[model samples]
Structures are given as structure tokens and as C-alpha cells.
Target: MSGHGFHVHGPHDHAVEHAAHGSDKFSGNIAVMTAILATVGAMFGYQGGATQNDAALFKNNAAIDKTEAANRWNYYQAKSNKQNLAELAMTLPGADAERYKADVARYKTEKDGIKKDAEKWEASSAEWNQKSDAAMHQHHQWALATTAEQIAISLAAITLLTHKKWLQYTAYGVAAAGIGLGAFAWLHVDPIGALALKLGMGAAGH
Candidate 1:
């Protein structure tokens, strides 16, 4: 699902329909699980799309700020060149040295202001870039969670077909992993990195 769009997998729906018709505890349970997983997957897909859009918007903002910063820097450079020219004029034998000196000072002041503006825009660009990266990371996490949910649903379908006990267990495990990934995404934590850090800390403690 993306934006206002919604979709259902035909195979999963067919499996769900078959499960719903059966008059057994196993079929009923599988049906319910599939339904729940479908809902969760839809939600995760939507969140993934939203985060991706946010990342793009933030990246665009970063580019705009970067462009503005470049423009300001260019303007600052122009002022510097003018200031240098004025200083050169001040060195001429019959030039109005005082007027040229005043011009140089004015250009210096203008350059300072432009430089400040450029720096401010550069900082803003960096902040936006960071936001873009964060949103992109969240999007990837949601995508992973959604993929896990999809795989779980597929496994559940296969279990329905084969009536295999292990397939059901595998589906449950996959669904749990999906939920864990979603939680990590919600908390803005990198699961792999966090796990690595924890292991490293435990090792160092010894």
C-alpha cells in the first residue's frame, strides 16, 4: 500500500479463503493468523512508503539549501574580487584613495554578511541531509519488516497446502522477526548495530 492505494495478494487471499472454510482448529488458527499478518503487512507497507517520501522531501530540501549556499558563496566571492580591485585602485598615484578605501571597506562588510549567509545555508543543508538519511534508514527498516511479513504469509499459505507443522512454526518465527524489525524502525534504532554494540560491550566486560 502506498498513499491512498491498497492491494491484496491473490494467492494469500485464496489461501485465506480455503482456511476459512475448513472446520478445524488448525484451519481457523491459520486463517486468523493470515488475516492479522495481512493487516500488519499493509500497515508496514504504508509506513515504508511514507518514510521514503519523507526522505525524498528532506533530500530535496538539502539540495535547495545547498544551491542557496552556493549562490551566497558566489556572491561573497564577487564582493571579495570587488574589494581587491578597490584596494588596487587605492594604490594608484592620482586615485581618490579615501573613496577607494571606503569602497573596499563596504565590500569587506558585504562579503562578511554573504559569507555568514552561506555558512548558515550550508549548516541547514547538512541538517536536512542528516534528516534525509534518517528517514531513508527508517524506510529500509519498514521495507525489511514488510518483506518478512510477506514471507510469513507465504509460509502460512504453504503450511495450509502441505499441512506441515514445521512450516507453521517457521511462519510464526518470520512474523515475529517482522514485528521486531518494525519496532526497531519505530524506535529509530539500528537492530544489527545495537546487537553488535551489545556483544562488543559484553566481550569488553570480561
Candidate 2:
């Protein structure tokens, strides 16, 4: 099929008619396999896009929270400076010491509230950062799975062209790998990270 001034044809497309009329079933098998791979690849691609969007959104939220935290901290610093000035006034010869003490106490209370608010925003930012990291990791997994499916589809095309039984089997293997990766992504498991953890533990044991 061609669309948007681009023509797309697989190697199998050229041999499809020839293989259909052949006495063997290779053509039919490759056709079915490619069709299945295409369907699965579409699903993986959609999931990848969704997770990527989630990652971006979550990261944006994290940035917003971080900015809020910074603003609160800046406010807290301003309050501290005012408190210091009040305390300095308490030591001055002509200043009302009692009024300066009250001001100092009020500023302490305000600073406490600001500090708590800043800490809450920092925690929220950290939580959002974690979620973004998770979504990005899942997006990578989906992308890798989609890549696997594309490779399988390519192998299917080549198998149809060369009629190589080995190529067909290889395509099936790659398709299975794609499915496995997709499953891991769906389950929110990072296989590569798990493997690394295991290896690190083993090394530590040694």
C-alpha cells in the first residue's frame, strides 16, 4: 500500500502471488505470521506512545512541584531574614524590645508553616519524579518490544522471498521475544534491571 506519496512494499509482497499458486504452504504460513506480527506491533506501538505521554506529563508535574518547593523555600528565607532583623532591633538602644520579641515569635511561626509547606512540595516532587521514571522505563520496554516485532516482520518477508525454513523459524522466535517483552511491560517489570540486580548480588556474594 502507498500513502502520502510514499509507496510501501515488503519483499513478500512481490512473491505473494507466486507463492500462492505454488504447491507448498510456505506462502500461506508467512502471510498469516506477518499479519499477526503487524497486529501485535500496532498494539505495542500504541502502548509505547501512551507511556511516553504519561512520562512527559508526570515529569511536568514534578517540575511544577519543584518550583513550588523552591518558591516556598525562598519565602521561608525572607521570613528568616525578617526574624533576624527583629532580633537585631531587640538589641538596639531605642527599639521596643517587647515588640521586637513578638515580631520574632510571629516570624518563627510563619517560618515553621512555610518550612512544612516546602517539605510537602519537595515530597510531592519526589513522588512525581519516581512515577515519571517508571513510565519512561515502561515506554522503553514497549519500544524494544515494537522493535522486535518489526524485525520479525522483516524476517517474515525475507523468508517468503527465499523460502528458507530457518528464516521462518527465526521470525517466529523474534515474534515470541516481542510478546515476552510486551508482557513484561504490561506487568511493570524491568527484566534488564532485574538481571543487573541479580548479577550485582552475585558479584557481592563472591
- TM-scores for all predictions: 0.90, 0.92
Query: Candidate 1 clash total?
Result: 0
Which regions of candidate 2 fall more than 4 Å away from where they truly are? Answer: 1-6, 10-23
Query: What's the lDDT for residue 51 in model 2?
Result: 99
lDDT of 2 at 196: 100
Candidate with best TM-score: 2
Q: Which ranges of candidate 1 are over 4 A from the true structure?
A: 1-9, 196-206
Give the least accurate 10-residue stretch of model 1, judged by summed lDDT. Answer: 7-16
**Residue by residue across 1-206, what tens digits does model 1's lDDT show?**
78979876654796779877888888778888989999999999999999999999999999999999999999998899899999999999999999999999999888889999999999999999999999999999999999999999999988888889999999999999999999999899997978899999999999
